[model samples]
Target chain A: MLAIFKREMRAYFTSPVGYMFCAIFYAVSGFLFMLNTVQAGESANYASYFSILLFLFIVIIPLLTMKLVSEERKMKTDQLIMTAPVTLFDIVMGKYLAALTMFGSAFLSSSILYYIPLAIYGKPNAGLYIGCVIGVFLVGSAFISIGIFISSLTENQFISAFGTIGAIIFLLFVSALNSFINNEAIRNFLNGLSITTRYTYFSNGILRYDSLLYFISLSAVFLFFTVRVFERRRWSKS
Target chain B: MIKVEHLTKQYGDRYAVNDISFEVKKGEIVGFLGPNGAGKSTTMNILTGYLSSTSGKAMVDGLDILEHPLAVKKKVGFLPETPPLYLEMTVKEYLNFIYDLKKCTLNRKEHILEVCKVVKIEDTMNRMIKNLSKGYRQRVGIAGAIIGNPEVIIFDEPTNGLDPKQIIDIRNLIRELGKERTIILSTHILSEVKAVCDRILIINEGKIVADELTENIEGALRGNRRLAIRIEGPSSSVLSSIKKIAGVIYADISVEHEDGSATFIVESKNNVDLRKPIFYMLAKNSWPILSLEFTGANLEDIFISVVDEADAEATVGKK
Candidate 1:
């Protein structure tokens, strides 16, 4: 598993994908920070910055996860890994961790931008700032997990990326769909299923156990589903 | 060692492999001869635990593939129909990845060097795989397969895309590997089997139609010759009389000309010439023989006949 992780990381850097991802991520976050808070003179309001970045997650998460397994299938390299002694769980987790580390790097760099502002200007609430950062990380993790699962479902990376983007968009759209529902219970259920709704709790500086659990469990569910997709494929045709 | 018992795989209602069984003793090189879609890849996939059998068992080194997949996988190496290569990595990097993927306990640097030397890819180690030609890529695939030096190695059409020289090189490499490893190689190329395999398993439509020693196949196919004759006689009587000849294995009147002379194709067993006996038999029956000729049954002939016979039986059963 560690070997897979290390190799996947190397694959990212050797190709243009990792640099492209970092450039797009940092550029967008910098632009957003400049427009939303810096120009608006809204000090200590990093929550809005992450909230805007969360929307950009739909486009960038696929960059991290689109070729996770799909490229292996396309290149037929999955045979080398599958026939090896490692289990499916290890392979999937190794890939997922690698993508997460890529996302983490961008997240850390953006956080450094936040630190610069805090050092030079008015002090931001450390708890709220940290909470928003964690919230954004959790949101990205869940989305990355979904992206990996989507990649496992198809061999074509184009379709995988679009499919992942569509899935994340639909999940995020679910919360805003609350008013259209007539039944209160159904509306509440859809709202609870909304990933963005769970992230809101962390961004508001409230450490809700349910929200943290929701993000972790959501990531787990998708990773489990990815593993199942691979495992089931061994016994049956795609 | 490898053993497969009634191993079957069905896709929906179609049997990709049906009730097929074979075994390979340690250090033996076995060739799986079959045409396309004859379940050669399916059987190899099942044996390697990449695909599960629907209603049978495949055991590698005595461990069942399903029950002990990791253990079994660790003991076997498989090169699928397409070489499973990561084109982005260099040859050395790819081999190192395989080493880690296979969790080889050997010293990584020495092991990669040794495998590269074995496949004769030592000079191309630092070159990216994408830059290498198809032949080099294939050798890299083989290098990956032998990384752990597993007990049993299965290769599915290992030389499918290679040029003539590369094919012979791979055949020689397989032959070299067969000295200590149990190797099961599947190919439709009959000459390849003739060139490398110690034993041969001819599969047709998911069934093992012929399983014999490679030497025996060569002797049986090369020695026995098919004879064609044009004789003036009652077709049934002449065929029956020709079949009764001691060395005649099969006889059939293939065509009757307008002149009333029938063309018969007779197969002799074990290289025995049936021309003299058939001529005497026809003479005793007062039939005039106009032409007699012989054709040796090459490996292509054996492969065709075996697969055709299987198809014929399958069609007959359906009817």
Candidate 2:
């Protein structure tokens, strides 16, 4: 697992995809940070910061994960990895962790904006900032797992990327689609399904275990699907 | 040692690898000979734990592949039809990654360097795989497969795209590697099997049609006896006189040239040596014999006959 992780991490940097992901992430986040806090002349509230962060996650999660398994399949390198002494869980987790690490690095870099506000205004609530960071990381991890699952389903990286983006966009707006529902039961169900609702608890400094579990479970479900995709391919004749 | 039992792989309604079974003993180099889509790659994939069989099981050493894939995979090295390589990585990086993935605890630097020396890719270790030529990339792929020093090595079309010189070099390397590891090579190149394999398994249409020692298989394909004779005489006289010999099956004039000389290829009855009879008859007829050479069946002939027979049977079955 460590070997696959190291190799995948290096491949990210060696190819232009890794640098492009980092640059786009930083560029968009930096612009959002400046526009939301500096230009607006409002006190730095992590609420706006996190709202923009969610937008960044929706776009960039696919970019970071689109090629994880899809590229391996396209290049036929999955044969080497799948045939090796490693298990399917190791492969899925290794790739997921590598992409998460890359995403985390970019996310952490953008956290520099939090400090800029700290210098200008009185110190914001430290606990809330930490919770928001954790929230973004967990949400991003869930998205990355989704990307991994999508990547495993096809050999075309473009399809994987766009598929993941479409799914995430749908999830992001699922709550809005439920607005017209007059039935309380349907509204509650749709609200629970919204990732933004789960993330809302973190942005407000409330660390709810239920929300955490939702993200973790979501990630697990997708990873399990990824493993099944590989297992079926390995067993079934092409 | 590897044992495959009644293994089958079916794609929807078609059997890519129909009910097939074979065994490879310790320290033996076995060749899987078949034309394209003859289940050579599929069989290798199943053996290496890259794919699971639709029915039956594959056992490596003593453990079943489906039940204990990691254990089987740990002891086996597989090079698929296309060398699975990450083009962005240099040879050294790719190999190091494979070593780690294979969970090798050996001296990493020493082992990798030795493999590089063996495959003759030492100088290209620092170069990215994308920049290397096809042959060098192939060597890198081989180097990766053998990195863990596994007991069994499976190579699928290892020499597909190499030049003649590189083919010879890789063949020699395979021969050397076969000394210690149980190697399974799958290819349509018959001469390669004759050159490197101890036993040959000829598969066609997902069936194991022939499995025997290379020499024994070749001999069986050649049948009990056959001979070719070169004669300096009129073609009709040579044919009639040779046919008159007791043990000879009719003689067919194979070649006729401007000089009016003919070469006849003769198929004789079992346990018959018609050479002396032919010589005496030719001398009596005043048709001097120029040269004679006995021809034996080779791997190519055996492969063709087996596949052709299978195809004919399939056609007959369809009707």
Candidate 3:
């Protein structure tokens, strides 16, 4: 498992995917921090910055994961990996953790760098800032897992990327679609189901165990599905 | 070291590998010979644990593949038709990754260098795999497979798409590797097995149509020794002399050369070395022997007839 993890980490930087992810992340996050906080005369406004970054995660996080499994299948490298002494869990988890570390590193480093200016120019709320970072990282984890899972289903990278987009949008926008419904019970249910609704608890500097469990379990369920995809393929007629 | 029993793999309603059984003892070089879509790759995949057999068992080194998958995988090295390479990585990184992935206990740098030398890819170790030609890439793939020095190695079309020189090089490499390890390689080319294998299994339409030692394939069907020889002497005298030899079934001029030389197709009794007697007779007559060859006898015809027979049976079964 460690071997696969290290290879994937090296692959990210060996190719352009790693640098591209960090670049897009820094540029957009810096711009968001400037527009919503620096330009708006709000010195320590992390809530708006992180919220926008969460929205951006829908696009860029998939970039980090689009080729993870699909490229292996396309190049037929899966034969080498699958035939090795490693188990299927090791394969899926190695790729999953490598992608998590990439997204987390970029997200964490940028969060800290942007926080530095806030500390100098204005008194930043350290507790609130920490809460938002933690919340965003968990959300990014969920998105990355979804991307990896979709990547497992097909050999075409474009299909994996677009399928991730469609799945994430439906999960994130469940709350937005709730306003059209007249029943309060259905609205509450959508609120409970929305990934964004639970995230609001963390972004507001309130730690909710249920929300944390939701994100962790969500990631596990998708990763479980990815491993099952491989297992089922062994029995597949093709 | 490898055994497969009643292994059947069905793809949809069609059986890709249908109740095929075979065994390979230690240090034997077995060749899986068949045409395209003849279940060669499917059988190799099942043996290497890349795919599960629909309803059969494959064992390598006394361990059942499905029951002890990781153990079986550890003992068998596989090189599929296309070398599964990370084109983005330098050969060095790829080798290191495989070494670690296989949980190899050998000294890391030294073992990798040794594998490179074995496959004759020493120069391409530092270069990215994508930059290398197809031949070099294949060498690197082979190096990766043999890294841990597994007791058994299986290759599917190891020489496919290679030039003649590269084909001969890989064949020589396989022959060398076969000396110490049990090896199974699949190919559609007949001469390849004749050149490198000790035993041959000819599969067709998901079944073994013929299985024989490489040396016996000709005699196994024809029950005689056939030789095509070119002689510089007159055609009439050479034909008469060859027919006069002991155990000579028949001798006839197959081709008449413009320079008074002729080629004769000689059929002799089985277990007879007619070349020695033919050589002595020509030496006594002072006629020089130009060229003498087995001509593959009836191996090609045998392969065709066997596969055709299997196809006919399948057609009849369908009706």
Candidate 4:
């Protein structure tokens, strides 16, 4: 599993995908920080900053994970992994952790740079900022798992990326539109299904352990699905 | 070292591998001969634990593949039809990944170097796999397969894209590997089987049509003895006299010369020798015998006839 993780991490750098993801992320987040907080003359506006970043994630997370499993299938390298002594769980987890590590490092370093200006210009609430950062990281982790799962379903990278983006968009918008529904029961059910609804607990400077557990559990569900996809292929391949 | 019993893999309604059973002892190299979609790859996939069979079981070293997949996979090294390689990594990096994935307990650095030397890919260790030639990439694949030094190795079309020189080199390498490991190689190239394999298994439409020692393949196909003769005599009378022999079943004239000479291929019942009687009768008839040679089916002939026979049986069964 360590071997797979190391190779996958190196692969992200050897190809242009890693650098492209980092560039897009930092550039967009830096712009959002300057426009929404610095130009507005409001200090410690981490909530709005994180919310916009969550929207940006719908596109960027897919970029990070589009080629993870899809490229392996396309290149037929899955044969080596499947025939090896390792279990399917090991393979899925190794790839998932590598993508998670990449996203976390990029998000952490850029957010740190953004924080320096907030510190100099005005007072920033340390607790709220930290909570929001962790929230966004958890959300990003969940999104990456979803992208990895979608990638396992197809061999084409573009299809995987688009499919993941579609799924994320649906999840993000459903929560925002939940209040417009007339029926209370239907609205509450959609609220429960919405990933952004759980994320709101962190952006509001409220650390809900249930929400944290929710994100972690979501990630496990998707990774498990990815492993099952591979397992089904073994029986169905003609 | 490997045994399969009544293994069947069904793709929807059709059986891709239909009730196939075979065994391979240690230190033996078996060649799987088949055209495309003949379940050669499917059977290899099951043995390597890359796919599951609908029913029946495959065992490697007394461990069933389905029940003990990881253990069975650890014992067998498989090179699929295409060498499963990551193009972004260098040759050394890819093999190192395989080493760790296999969970090898041997000294890593030394084992890798020994495998590279065995496959003759030591020079390209630092070069990325994307930059290497197809032949070199194949060598890297072979290097990966032989990394853990598993007791059983399965190769699917090991020499598909190689040049003539590379093909001969790989054949020699497989022969060398066969000295210690039980090997199964699948290819449609008959000469490759003739050169490297000890036994041959011919598969047709997902069924094993012929399975025997490579040396006996031709003899097994030719159930009756055949003799080809050229005679300098009247074509009609010579053929009739040759057919008149007690043991001869059929004699077909193949070629007729302008000078009343003819060539005939004679089939004798069982393995009996009809040469002495034909010689004596020809001498009595004043027909001079130009040439007489005993002949049996070659590998190509055996392959075609066996597959054709299977097709004929299937059609008759359909009726």
**RMSD in order of candidates:** 5.3, 2.2, 3.2, 2.6
Model 2: interface root-mean-square deviation in Å = 1.1
Provide per-model DockQ scores: 0.62, 0.82, 0.77, 0.73
Off by over 4 Å in 1: A42-44, B218-268, B271-294
Residues A77-113 of candidate 1 have per-residue lDDT tens digits of 8888888999999999999999999999889778977
Model 1 chain A weakest lDDT span, ten residues long: A36-45
Model 1 over residues B1-319: C-alpha lDDT tens digits?
Answer: 7889998898888899999988899999999999999999999988888888888889987889899989999999989989998888999999998898888999989989999999999999999999999999999999989998999999999999899999999999999999989999999999999999999999988899999999898565454678889999788888888888897777887898998889999987766768788888899889999998875577898889878888999999999
**Steric clash pairs (candidate 4):** none
Off by over 4 Å in 4: A42-44, B230-247, B256-262, B273-296
Q: Which of candidates 1 and 4 reaches a greater lDDT?
A: 4
For residue B68, give model 3's deviation from the true position in Å. Answer: 1.2
- In candidate 3, how many Å is residue A15 off? 1.5
What CA RMSD would candidate 4 show? 2.6
Tens-place lDDT per residue, model 4, B9-126, is 9998898999999999999999999888899999999999999999998999999999999999999999999999999999999999999999999999999999999999999999
Q: What is the Cα-based lDDT of residue B233 in candidate 2?
A: 83
Angstrom error at residue B71, model 3 = 1.2
Model 3: lDDT equals: 0.91
Error of 4 at B17 (Å): 1.0
Q: Per model, how many backbone clashes are there?
A: 0, 0, 0, 0
Q: State how far residue A90 of model 3 sits from its true place (Å).
A: 0.5
- Of the true interface contacts, each candidate retains a share of 0.82, 0.94, 0.86, 0.86
Q: Report clash pairs, candidate 3.
A: none
Relative to the true structure, how large is the alpha-carbon lDDT of every model? 0.90, 0.89, 0.91, 0.91
lDDT of 2 by residue, A42-159 (tens): 5646567777788777778998899999999999999999999999999999998899899988888778555666666766677887888889888898989999999999999999
